[model samples]
Target: MIRIKRIYEQLGDDDGYRILIDRLWPRGVSKENAHVDLWLKEIAPSTELRKWFGHDPEKWKEFGERYRKELSEEEEKEDLRRIKDLEKEHENVTLLYAGKDEVHTHALVLLEMINKKSS
Candidate 1:
């Protein structure tokens, strides 16, 4: 199974590789503070897409679709392929993002897409 959560969430008892998915460095989080196994910035949506959406709640649905498109376009499929390898070894994989709004963030869309694909 795979899971998604914000980096701010408690990490204890979370037993899987922790990967951060934001392109830019998260707000005030230090590298030491974030117990991340991988920071897959390469899988994040492009800068133009991020700026265009600007975390606007109104654009969330569209942003999700666009972000998913960008993910495929960015050749991040390789990472997905790699994650599958990890899944074979581990029971869960948590994709961590730093977005404040839990509902409208790209991470949710990505989690949906990834889980759907894995299924």
Candidate 2:
């Protein structure tokens, strides 16, 4: 399963392989504090798409679709391929993001996509 978690959340045994999906490094979080196995900047939404969405509720649905499209591209697909390989190699995969609005962030959309592909 793919679980979405915030970078500030404490690391635990349950989080088998923590992967940060944000294109840019999170503020106030040192690399050592992140406790992530991998930082897949390639998997994040394109800069243009991310800026356009801006976390506005009205643009959320469209943002989800667009992000998925961005994910399906050749470059992002390579990242997805790596993630899938890791999922098969690990017990669990934790997707880490820095967004304060966890429920409405790109990580949730990435989790949904991962779940769909896995199922």
Candidate 3:
């Protein structure tokens, strides 16, 4: 199974194979504390798109659309495939992100895409 959690959340044994999906490292979170198995920054939305969205609820729909288009690139496809591979190899995979607005984050869009593809 795949799960999404905030990077700042307390680490748990159930958070198997944690992967950090943010383009930028969250401020004040050290590597040791993060306990992340992989930092797949490439899977994150483009900086341009991120800045434009600015976590505004109004732009969420368009943000998802633009982010989906961004993920269609070859490099992003490879990264997404890697995530799928991890899910198969591990009992559970947790995607970690630093965004404050969980509902409007790229990680949510990425999760939807991944789950949609799997289904």
Q: Which runs in model 1 stand beyond 4 Å of their true positions?
A: none
Question: For candidate 3, lDDT tens digit of each residue in 1-119?
Answer: 89999999899888889999999999999998899999999889989999998889999999999999998898988888889999999979999999888778888899988887678
| lDDT: worst 10-residue window of model 3 | 99-108
Write one digit per residue (lDDT tens) for candidate 1, span 26-91. 888889988888898988888999999998999988898888887675378777777667767776
Q: Model 1 Cα displacement at 84 (Å)?
A: 2.2
Residues forming the 10-long window of minimal summed lDDT in candidate 2: 110-119
Give the poorly placed runs of model 2, Cα more than 4 Å off. none
Each candidate's TM vs. the true structure?
0.91, 0.93, 0.96
- Where model 3 places Cα greater than 4 Å from the true spot, the runs are none
Candidate topping TM-score? 3
Arrange candidates, best lDDT first: 3, 2, 1
By TM-score, is 1 or 2 better?
A: 2
Flag the better candidate by lDDT, 2 or 3.
3
